[model samples]
Target: MIHKAGRASRAAFRQADDEAFGAQQNGSMSKSMPTAVEAITGQNWQSIFVPKVNCCEVAHADRAAVLVDGANYFSHLEATLRRARHSIFIVGWDFDGRIRLRADQPADISPPLGALLRGLVEDRPELHVYILVWSVSVIHGPSATAPALLGSPWQDHPRIHMKLDTRHPLYAAHHQKIVCIDGRVAFSGGIDLTVRRWDRNSHRADDGERVDLDGTIYPPVHDIQMIVDAEAAAVLCRMAAERWSDATGEKPSSTAGKNDDIWPRQLPVQFRDVSVAIARTSPAYGGRAEISEIGTLTLDMIAAARTSIYIEAQYMTAPAVGDALAARLREPDGPEIMVVMTHTSKGLIERFAMASNRDRLIRRLAKADGHDRLRVVYPVVPSPQGQTQVLVHAKLIIIDDTLLRVGSANLNNRSIALDTECDLAIEARNEADRAAIAEIRNRLLAEHLDCAEADMAETIATEGGLIAAVDRLNVKMRGLRPFSAMRSPGPTRPIFGTSIFDPVRPFRLSLPFVSRGRSGAWRAPEKEL
Candidate 1:
């Protein structure tokens, strides 16, 4: 029997669905084909990605840049931190103080991240640094560096306030990764300020610099970080403060002054004067209502695609997203879909749960692709020894060169409904914005193919589509390979594996086994086991 609260949720979702479908029907009836420039720039963006109610406010940024890999991101972050005059706030899933910031400097010249921050605080009397990390233990096997050191020296410095967030529901985590400096500039995306994340754009199969605190080498890792300034930076600072308050029960007032320019001088601006949308996902916990704007935005973007949908994520298992994609694929002239992901997951539970679900969704989408418009591949670069597949941990989506999104949320159930996530979406508002968005996508493709950006752009123009361009450029040396599905859980899936561990719906076992209702009514959730 459907519980009262479950019924209410279903009803609310049905209402949302009706509204979206109604809007789409109205949009379809319009007999107007916009010009290329108009379509790419101001193409009904407000209708496509509406702001989540009470989740995030629309903000403006004077400048924005997309840092492709951790190497560039960390270097720019270190530079910004070095020049931070008032305050610094970092919010992420994991953070390690031992990770070295400067790869080119000697040990004496370049200190560890912890030492660097400590020295900064000591040098600047007014500088106050705040770090908030998820309170969870993880064993990254030999692939990643040291285990996250969330204790001691991280909080030993009086000026550096460190907090392990435990305010989330059971098994749910605060997964938003953000960094703000002096309330003027902010960075957000999938990357955490941790070890084993530093790597050059080349993504060499065997790089000496990709080492742990103990000098142990790891595989190539890729991620994206979006930088923003002006009101966008202020919005991120406010998010940090809200999370800090939620975790520590202390409302930390912002020390950031408006109009302070903290954007790095060395970084190139990818887009100037762009409006950024900060979408979030936070489960209802500690008396707060759940926020799923990021999830909504993901689905809306997928539905809004007209030509192509390009995505790079760690995992793909959200049912709502999969259903939306399947519907789009069934359309006769639907957008071509291209997804880039890790060949396989690393953790045992993730492999069993996420991969199992991913394969299921892939099969579903494949069945819906009657026109053969779907392509899924993983990037692999060949070195002197053997083929090394670069791990695709980037959470990014590009829709028809008109919309670009980057964030910490994975294409997974947890990211949609459980963990806290933050994403920045930029709608192309002019020819420059469209060019920047396309350049970012082409640059990513070039990096994977180990080809020049100009060549990549030329090939894409020649081939007329990204998939065909990728197919033509893909060679044995360094190129994207079709993802081979790993062994799936098969027809009789075990409930204890996914349902209990990587649950689609975040549940609080310690609570009174009740779901909050709009009318203050409570009811038991549907039985999962």
Candidate 2:
């Protein structure tokens, strides 16, 4: 039986859907689509960003750019780090001290990350560096935990502080990847500063540059990051400081007055003078309330899409998100939906836990795709050894050129409610903003389809929709391929169905000898066995 509150919530969502699509039913929405200005500043179209509901805040950015792959993101990050003066904050799920920020540069100039940070502090006496990483990274992450737990030469400086965060609930990870320099510039997205996450946009299968510190070669990968300046940077700085304080019980000095013009000169700007929203996900623990702003914002963005919804993600096992998408697919005149994900999970544990669950969700969505409006795919690139998949590690979404989101959250149960995450979003304010957003979306699709951005745009225009364009251009050796649902073996089926390994909330442990009364008070069992 559905609870009263659940019924009311469904009703509210239905009303919102009707209001958003009413014009289409009257046969005028196609001709009367809201202009960019009207969608952003007018009351007729309710904005998807609502403070304390879907996002923490909406702040203005002087400039913002999308970094498509590691080759682009790392070089720009290296340049921006060189200009830091007062403070730097690095927060992530994992971190490697041996990785070079600028792999193309010589070792003398672009040293390992640890050496570079030490050099920066030595050269600038006023500068301080702080790094926070998840405590459980030692068990399952790519970075070596020995140096992080014990002291190393790079971590000996008094001005440099590194701490492992253990404040999350059991099985939940601290998954935000953020970097703020002097409160002037900030980066937030899926690309982590660790092993097996660096690759060029070309995604060449045998690229010589894709090697780890131990000389182990890795397969091609794909990810994204976003850099922003002005008020947006300051907001991210504050958020990082708060996380640092929550973990270590020591608040670093405020970065209020150190905002200098430190935007990377070489990075191209995607939007100027646009508003950006910061969304987060933190589970309830230790008296702190749960915050699922990113989850709520994703649903709202899906509900508001008028033409298409594009996504690239690492996993696709979030029940609520799958249900919302299924509902959208059930609509007769609904927007087209496309999702690009990894072809296979990485390790044995990931295969057992995530892969099986992913197939289940895909099957559910397929059942609800009555209008043929859904396409789930994986990207593959040509290799001399045959075709190899470009591992998708990006968390991105584009909704009808009206919204763009990039973040560290995966499309999984933990990211929806249990894990910690941070996502940056931009809502198009005018025609220029809309065009910029569309260009980024097209650029990503072009990279996947192994074509030029101009060609992608022309094909989409010619074919009348994204699905048609993809079909028309996906004949090359390197292109998108559809995903097929897989059935797990007998032994693992029940384990995956229980969802114990991928719980959506913190584990609640209770002793067998105790019982909870109707008033929520713990007491001894009336009849003990």
Q: Of the candidates shown, which would achieve the greatest TM-score relative to the real structure?
A: 2
**What tens digits encode model 1's per-residue C-alpha lDDT throughout 1-529?**
0011122223333344333333233422111111111123443333344455413666899999999998899889998898887788999888887777777567677678888888898898888888888876344322133334435464577788877787877788778989988888999998888877888898887788888778777889889999999999889998898889888988764559543466888999989988888989887776687787776667657756788899999898655566677777888988889898888677788887777767766776776688878887888888777788898889999988888999999987677667899999988888899899999999999998889999999998998888788888887578887754422233322223454555545654433546877777776654311
Clashing pairs in 1: none
| Candidate 1 wrong stretches, greater than 4 Å | 1-47, 53-55, 138-150, 153-155, 258-260, 486-497, 508-529
lDDT of each: 0.75, 0.81
Candidate 2, number of clashes: 0
Q: Which candidate is the best by lDDT?
A: 2
**How does candidate 1 fare on TM-score?**
0.86
RMSD of each: 7.5, 7.6
* Per-residue error (Å), model 1, residue 300: 0.6
- Give candidate 2 regions above 4 Å deviation: 1-43, 257-259, 486-498, 512-529
For model 2, the local distance difference test gives 0.81
